[model samples]
Target: MAKNTGKAYEEFVRTIQQSLITAEGMSHLKNIEVETNKKLTDRNGIERQFDVYWEFDLGGYVYKTVIECKDYASSITVEKIDAFIGKTADIPGLRLIYATKTGYQSGASIKAEQHKIDLLIVREADEREWTAEDGTPLIKTIQLNIVALTSPRITSFAPNVDTDWLEKQKDLNADIINHAFTSSLNNEIFISNESTGHKFSLFDLSHLLLKKIPDIQYGKGTFSEELDNSYLETKAGDIKIKIKGYKLDYEYHAPITTSSVIDYSKDLLGIVEKYNTGTKQMIFKDGKIK
Candidate 1:
């Protein structure tokens, strides 16, 4: 459990860092490389491990950053910050950033700021975090309407054949009425409207019927689309057929309405850390929201 928890935290940090480097978010950054559990040798030739390490190239120069994460239940102390400072001293040219689950102790902030290290409290956002300057909490509620559609069942299919056109063509079989323009249950044949020249397949017709299902509040319903001047292509030749229509029966249950207010602490994929004066981002546990 502890190993899984640590890995989860590392990924959470790496994922949010990716979001930050995007053009829509941070500026003066591009072509970033981020990783977790990166180990690098210090000036003393001793290897040091970083919870999260990232670098970016901008204007022909590369900026290296190392982030240390502490998933403690309690606030971080100044002693921890001191240890982090010493840990990074030998690893020169590194921008230092530290993150924790809770927050920093009273003097920890001053100490970290003095050393030019940024401190962040990364965790789930709470309702109290969303508030106006006057302390009035903003409500995060949404109303969703889910309309349910039943499987469409085709009741009957009738294809009208153009016998006049068939009579003109001598090579076509005269008994085309029975074999031609027939509906294939698997939608294997393509047909078109003789007058409008609109092509349709059995699958397309099914989709059309699904789209045409009437918006009814409740109960079962029967519907159909009138199709005319339709023709089917056959092995003998193109057979002009007029389709009366496709009749279908379907049921539409009443829409289900749900009203919900977002609880960031419990409902989201992960937590977010808002800096005092920087880009705001959410760090998901799985490293992504979508």
Candidate 2:
């Protein structure tokens, strides 16, 4: 099980490594090779295996980078960073990166900075403002329908007309109305009109519906409205429906931002140390590191 887990993690690291390289515009580096579980012999003839290894050339100089993947539940310690630094000393010009799922300990970050090694934390991207095709901030919208029944209860709420629009409604009604329920107030029923493509979840739809149509049980008859961009219609028969149109929801992948490089020919260590100290001071004052 441990072996299988390690292989799975190696594959994941390889995939992310390739993506990061390409996304960061490092693909121009010649002889760009990314490998998993690559073995190398040290000066003392001791074999060391790396989780993910990469090498490339830039400006006529070839550089090697060794990435260590730690799929640990807890944060990585400074001891691990020290061991990795020792390995780097054995192999000259070996740029080191420590990737951890749970991030690094406080000392680990300082140690990594001292060694001029990169520390990367793997996790889900946080929710942020995202724009759509027309530069409008993408939003999730939900439309729901609440029906008032007089005598008979609605067992099913299928689309009435056989038009193309109504045919689409038939399938949508099946998807949403399956969760419909009959209330005790004069056999009145509440059915939501849920259609995909809006990226809204069912809980979000329900919350929006309650806010928009607060008095669902007071209405006597059916009503319909045609707004500028949306429509709300109602039909009465064996099953009454007060619902709105729906569209399919789509998933969007955000583009990665480019990273700035620190030139090693300059005072790289001094710059890194100053930056780290400034970051910690900022965190102490503003309650955030970045």
For residue 178, give model 2's deviation from the true position in Å.
Answer: 56
Candidate 2 has an lDDT of: 0.52
For candidate 2, the per-residue lDDT at 191 reads 32
Residues 18-132 of candidate 1: C-alpha lDDT, one tens digit per residue = 6555524444565566789999899999999999998877789778899888878888899999999999999888999998778888688889989999887666566644676
Q: Quote the positional error of residue 13 for candidate 2 in Å.
A: 2.0
lDDT of 2 by residue, 168-234 (tens): 5554574344433232221233233334213332234333433444544432322222212222222
* Model 2: per-residue Cα lDDT at residue 199: 32
In order of appearance, the predictions have TM-scores of: 0.53, 0.43
Clashing pairs in 1: 160-241, 160-242
Off by over 4 Å in 1: 1-5, 23-30, 129-137, 146-290
TM-score quality measure for candidate 2: 0.43
Best by TM-score: 1
